[model samples]
Target chain A: MSIARFSPFELLLLKSRSQVDTATLLLLAWVLVHRQHVSEGQRRRRLAQVTAQFRHGHELGPIMSIAHSQDLQAIQLAAEVVRKECSNERSLSALYQAITLATDDGDLSLANHYILRFLADLLNIAPSTLSTLFQELTGKPLCPPEDPSRDAYWQQHDPEYHARQAQEAQAAEQQAKEAHARAEQRQRAQTEKQQKKQQKQQQEQQRQQEATRNAKARAQREQAQREHDQHEQARRTRWQQEQARQEEARRRQQHQRSSSPPPADRTTRALAVLGLAPGASRTDVRQAYRRMAQLHHPDRFYSESDHLVALASARFQRIKNAYDYLMQTY
Target chain B: MRDLYQRLALSPSANSHQISSAVTHCANSALRQDAETVLGVAEHRDAYNKLHKTVSDIGQLRARLGLTHGAHWQGDVANDFSLPPDNAISRHDELVDRVSYAVSLYNHWRRFKGPLLLVALFTAGAGIGLAFGFTLGLGLGTR
Candidate 1:
């Protein structure tokens, strides 16, 4: 793949064996390519670009200082090391990265082109390949027309440049404020959603509790109804039993009354046996009993046959029984 | 007339003197003793005569009421005047019958209560278990 997709520091680190050597080489190449005198603003801008590409921001300061010193021996050493460490493809990729960095300002100086050619020669790349790679990256010939109008060095000293810088800074501050407001709004929306969820859960719990209470109350009422029905059944049974008992007692009393004879019947029969009327006096009952007794007495029939005497004895016994009954009843 | 008077073949108006002579001349000693017991005491004779009189009066009443045959009387004064088989129950006997009825009812309840209670408890437990299982199933299904 072409190293055009990779940043300058990333390509340098990938091709170099040591991280410190790669950083030094990358910075040294950048400084050498921008060797012409430039404004401090341009220098700081270039340093900012390098620092942004470098993964380790804290270490870039010392590497940038060393590269800015323009020490020829350190430059030569970094170049030699890069040349020895890189293969042909990696050497081409490293050179391509450097070309990309140089064109970031929209232009390359003649001196920067010379330095690139020197780096290509040191890495053993053919001059034709360097021209082709540079053309491919920048869409221009290796040697191009000098255009001072494209150079920003004079504009950096202009009053309008300072005003544009102030405007850009103000716009950046306004964007930061808007971003903070959006984040606060998102946080508020999230908190409100959480509170709504909590309220829904509480309402569901209350509904479940009400259902449970209703079920419990229904069970209690059903139990009470069952108990009441049982009590009613018992009461009905007792009432039925009491009614049966009263019926039996009434039947028994009726039976007794029906079976026993009346007292008046006995008095009339006793008077009849004495040969007296129903309303006869006690004296008349006695006189009739005595008269019947004398006539039917067994002693008066003693001279008769055994049969006759037996007959007389039975007759006399009846008359005697009737008299005794009459005397006591009267 | 009473059986005692019938046994001696005597009239209903026979006196105490004639009753004694009849008893003395009776053929059977047992018959003589019975006749003596019934006729010798005025109170016993009265009770005997009254019993026969009650039977006779009942017969007369039946005739007056135009009830033919006199099925319950039949001139057997001893049987007729005897109490009507004493069918009325005593208090103790009735109490015993009532207690037995109560005991039988209790036994019937006892016979049913154990299985009924077990069925009730089992039904309640099964319902509770089913409800609990259904609730747990719903909860798990929701999850």
Candidate 2:
């Protein structure tokens, strides 16, 4: 970068006589476009110097043809050839410096901007890297070489065109990230909802099963109670009927005993005194007593002789004695 | 010793009707105060029987003598004992009717014995069957 130590122009003069390759031709064009002279005499002196250098090497015709060409074809062709020869970082840096100086202007031309982009493409340098190189060479901001909204040729020729293509690329990347995040959130929420629904269904099923089991148990208990009550009722009824039968039998036995006759014995002898049979019943004995007492009662013989009443009373007394003995003994 | 006729307040030569009437009168006098007493009535009845037997013996001797004197006995033989009163006979008939009613009731019981036994058996069987059925139903229901 120091003019006193090493100059691009002097370097070109040294390589001029050795070969007239595309690198040597590009160096010459770079010097013609970027170099400044204090006076016309200075410009004339440099031109003479370059011409003499090519004439001494007997390559003046080709060099002069390139210098006098009114198009950027030679510059484009030179850039292609230099791209092959200069692949190292130092050579790329030197080429970047030369392009920067050639394109530098208070107001840049469309032809110069096109030639710069064409050279950078051949050299496989990114447009952004070229901007960084431009800043390094001129200590100023780099102008991007794209603008689709304008006329394609006009944007290339426009000055003060330093816009960023990086913002658009970053925005596309951020949008993709946001879309992916939203999709993941929706998937997670759906999975949680499905799990909750399944859990609720399982709980409902369990409750139903429990309720059914309880109902079955209750029904069973109620049925058992009813049956037990029925069985108890039957048992009570049977017991009551049996009791009634026993009472009936006892009543009949009592009636028979009271009505039946007494056995023949000392009581039977007494019964005979009342004109009853030997094996007479207790009822017969009472009947006999009533009969004899009525017949031989003293009142019956009151009107008759004393002897007759005495006889009736004696007989009645005998009957009464027998009746008493029979009743007491039996 | 006092004679049997004297005990009955009769003369030794009295006829059978006169002797029987006189004996009844004497016995009635002795039994009238305590006729309801068993011991008194028994004692009176025993005395009357003994007197009657002795009087009959005396009468038989007298009858033999009378027969030698050409006297015939003309009294009915049934006149010696008295018949029971009509009310006594009616009481006896009433007793017979009661006994007959009791007999009829017993006969009715005998005639219906088979059906009554069958009813009792059916009741018992039905009770047992109902108990068993209820027990089985309860067991199954509980299970």
Q: Write the residue-wise lDDT of candidate 1 on A104-136 in tens digits.
A: 655775435535644565567776788898889
Q: What is the TM-score of chain B in candidate 1?
A: 0.44
**Ten residues in a row with the worst lDDT in model 1 chain A?**
A145-154
* Model 1 spans > 4 angstroms off: A1-58, A144-330, B1-143
Give the per-residue lDDT of model 2 (tens digit) for A149-254: 1223222443222123346667899999999999999999999999999999999999997787677878787887799899999999999999999999999999
Residue pairs of candidate 1 with colliding backbone atoms: A314-B8, A314-B9, A314-B10, A315-B9, A315-B10, A315-B11, A319-B11, A319-B13, A319-B14, A320-B14
Residue range B36-134, candidate 2, lDDT tens digits = 121123343344344344234323322322221211111211122112222222222333355566668799999999999999999999999999999
CA deviation > 4 Å runs, candidate 2: A1-24, A27-65, A71-77, A103-107, A145-330, B1-143
Quote the lDDT for A238 in model 1: 100
Tens digits of per-residue lDDT for model 1 on B30-97? 56755665676675566456445434433332333232232222233323223332233332233335
